[model samples]
Target: MKSITVRQLADQFQLEVLVGEEQLQREVTKARAHRPGLEFVGYFEFFPTEHVQILGKKEINYLHALTDLERNLHIGNIVKYHPPCFIVTSDQSGLKYLKRYCEEEGIPLLRTKLRTTPFIGALDAYLLKVLAPEISIHGVCLNVSGIGVLLRGKSGIGKSETAHTLIRRGHRLVADDVVVLKKLSEQTLLGTHNEVTKEFLALRSVGLVNVVRLYGRKAFQDETRIVLDIELTKWRENELNNELELEPKFVKYMDVSIPHIEIQLQPGRDVAGLIEAAANNWYLKQQGYSAAEEFMKRLEF
Candidate 1:
């Protein structure tokens, strides 16, 4: 199983470490955080020790309401299980109950100023991306007119060149040359560039191009959901277009079949414009409008 160090989670959210400083290096195996409400009230039937524990306002207040002996007993039940860490949300100050035990047991006790709901949401988002199934492919993913378009084809088939043109035309580049795609859901894929080369774009003749230096931040977006897949095929006179239909077709990647389009390429063809048009057409179809369907209705009339 993939895991991230507790220190990574603390650093990402700017969480303050209250105790167990040395244990920050310990790995967090689960992506989800657990809030043990019933456990505090003396129910430990289905204790989830696998996930990190979070304490919100309600749980902290309940512990404070209990007598010293009761509080100690309730906290003991939680500490004995060896949870990865304890995160106190909303900066609740009364949870001095957790610090001593967490320190003695070497479990990280962290505090965040963010409210419990937003903090858990952000933590879950980050953890899901880090722990999710991922694949790297040779393609360029861009945001064209608010649509996530992934350009994929054989090497030297002008994927980068087409992406370069799209960037010049004010479309944001999510990833170029190599795209890291993470499956966020069964139907959704998140596309992004590698951390080391996120700001660089590659070209055949000129080598590496710094997109940030040339186009600045406006031309770059961190990541996008890959909603459309366009495959650039070398133009063959006799080839037929099979994927073009009123009913949408898809290109499969790790069980995610995104709406797919195949564009035949020849020298001097306006490939970038065609890509933009395809995105717009797909967007139109999504909103219950199709040019093909309208044309067929005209033929019937």
Candidate 2:
């Protein structure tokens, strides 16, 4: 979990502050931005204070159409609840008076030149990324054949090296070493790297190497949704029975169950190739084709 402040949002969008500059440090904790649609209709029973309010053209016009008493009473009622902030879109004028009530309540009042739809679209996306629930895992996340694959195993078990190989084969690396995983939605887990480790991978013999510098920009992706988890393990004679996998194991990240596979490594085994195959196979499963299930059906096993 990360904390995002009103100041950060204001700075990110380059919004102009109309008042309550001192309260800009207030946190913007919710991903859903509210429009006060219910509040204006005299419904305050479920006013969501968690959301950052947006006053678009419709709301602005509605306000001006009302009598002075009605408008003041409505604005006062809403402002008293104290939302994270109020963002007026379209550079709409004549609404700065809303700033008066906002200032009285110590709520930050802001404005953006972007129209309502695009600003809200970008704002929702920004909030989704920043306020998403996050966890840190040790692995290399990559975009392989449009599927997000996470490589996890023991330390120095060649995860980074396998990822390097994948990058060379035209796949894109999302993160190496410390993979930051964020739950963008109930089922989507997005993997990324922090500033310190982004675009860099460490190998046993070679030191830290920037994949983008060597492989160029096409070999790197800032973030990718993790659809598969692949763990590499030293090949063991006892586990040979499971080598011909008929089913994929399941792993959970933030309560989302994702398909999991394990690859046993040997001296000459193509680890990268197997991982790539797993990604493609998972993608195929998504499109209603499962090799393991088909094989089992043919064998009647």
Candidate 3:
């Protein structure tokens, strides 16, 4: 992750720092880590380092005199301070002592026009990539209301077909044919658009179809969490009684056991609608409701 300096942050928004201008050379942490300094900027013992900074308009005026002892604290000692970048929420009346201190210390004061939530969202996304361990996977990705549903099948039982149908049903398509999967956490997989297959899909009769023209902006997305997996299998009459999902079925992708379901496909079935139903069912399951369990309860004597 790239580190940000107080000066750089200040320059980005043209804000003046209130104090610690001499400490403008401090290094900002870009990503999350187990290291005590993961969320802080600069290492201890660095002579020209920034220890504390504020971001907001209202809070900047509240900061007062900095004691000699507070200033004498080493980089390591200051890191323990964990001062937050005070994000200004509104326009300030005028400059204060802190701003002058920032100028004297060469510490950067920054401002942002974005709302608090959006600014943090953008910042967090950038930071996650730097801080989190990530991995990629090869499969098909479907975005249903922001949830990434990955489909896995050998050769061509009908991964693309199901994805196409799902899109027609108002769901967004992340990737088809060849999905590039990435692991974002210990238990979460993020599916996203692959350059090779972005806005494209292969249909048995239609060949390659443009998902954007056919479905529009809502029908496509950059990436989403891989929350469900549907495996396509050729229909077999003899397998019904033998098949069992008493325990939840799952597939391993990057050390994560993704929740999954198997759908037997054959002629004369509305596969598209079925997949949609499966998605709804999976969503309901997340809310602690299961159709099969409810049916079983009704059948009990």
Candidate 4:
């Protein structure tokens, strides 16, 4: 499982370290933050140990209301559970006993100046992005007419060459050779280039080339939401030619299905132009305009 360390979170949010200096390397496995309100009141059965414990103003006020013995008992139970870390929000700084306890137990305790709600929201977003399910695809991803199109095919089938042609024609390339796809949410897949291969494309004979440097920054995009999946296949003599009325196809990745299309590869064919047209056609279909349906309507009329 992918996990983020306390030190990384502290550096990202500029959290102040109040105690547990040696626990900076503790790993946070969960994306959700936990509020220890109930735990502070001696409800220990349901306390989440994997989540980062967040103490807001209300919880702190409740803590301050308790006698030293009561507070020690409550905090001691929490410390015994060994949570990933603790965060006090809103810059409140009157928890000397809690800080001392955390220091003694070697549990990382941090404080942030952000309000409780916004801090929780931001942390949730960051964790979601970092911990989201990811997969690598052997294809090229591009933004064509605002639609993220992923081109897939066997080696030497001109996927990269087609992407290069599309780039030259003003479309932006998200990734070439290998596209790293991350499921940002249930229905959304975000595609990005592998770090070592960012902005670089490998051609058959021309070798490695930097698309961003050659065509400027406009030719490359950092990431794009994949909406369409297209596969290129070698042209066959007896292949069906129902070009106007193609059935809807979908390709599933990471439990999400995206619209899919297949294009035949042949000599003297404008594959790049066809891809651009396919992207625009997909956009039109999204707007409730289907050329194939319109043609079928005309035929029936």
lDDT of each: 0.89, 0.89, 0.61, 0.91
Tens digit of per-residue lDDT, candidate 3, span 1-301: 3466656555654654544556666666543212223222334453222223323432333322234343333222433344433334344434454344444444444455654445555555654543344444555788776566888777778888778878887898888766766666788777776587788888888899888988798888877888888888889887745422245788887688888877788899887776677777778878998776777788995
Q: Candidate 2 on 148-250: residue-level lDDT in tens?
A: 9989999989999898899999999989889999898989889999878988988789989999899899999899999999999988887756534555579
List runs of model 2 lying over 4 Å from the truth. Answer: 242-245, 292-301
TM-score per prediction, in order, is: 0.93, 0.94, 0.65, 0.86
Which prediction has more favorable TM-score, 1 or 3? 1
What is the lDDT ranking, best to worst?
A: 4, 2, 1, 3
In lDDT terms, which candidate is top?
Answer: 4
Q: Count the backbone clashes (under 3 Å) in each candidate.
A: 0, 0, 21, 0
Q: Give each prediction's root-mean-square deviation over alpha carbons.
A: 2.0, 2.0, 6.5, 2.6
Give the better candidate number (3 or 4) by TM-score.
4
Clashing pairs in 4: none
Q: Report the lDDT of model 3 for residue 208.
A: 95
Best by TM-score: 2
Weakest ten-residue segment in model 1 by summed lDDT: 240-249
lDDT per residue as tens, model 4, 1-301: 8898999999999999999878899999888899998888778788789999999999898889989999899899888889989999999978999998898888999999999999999999899878878999899999997889999999899999999999999999899888999888889998888888899988889999999899999999888999999999999888857677678899999998999988898899999999999899889988999888888899997
Better of 3 and 4 by lDDT: 4
Please identify which of the two predictions, 1 or 4, would achieve the higher lDDT against the true structure: 4
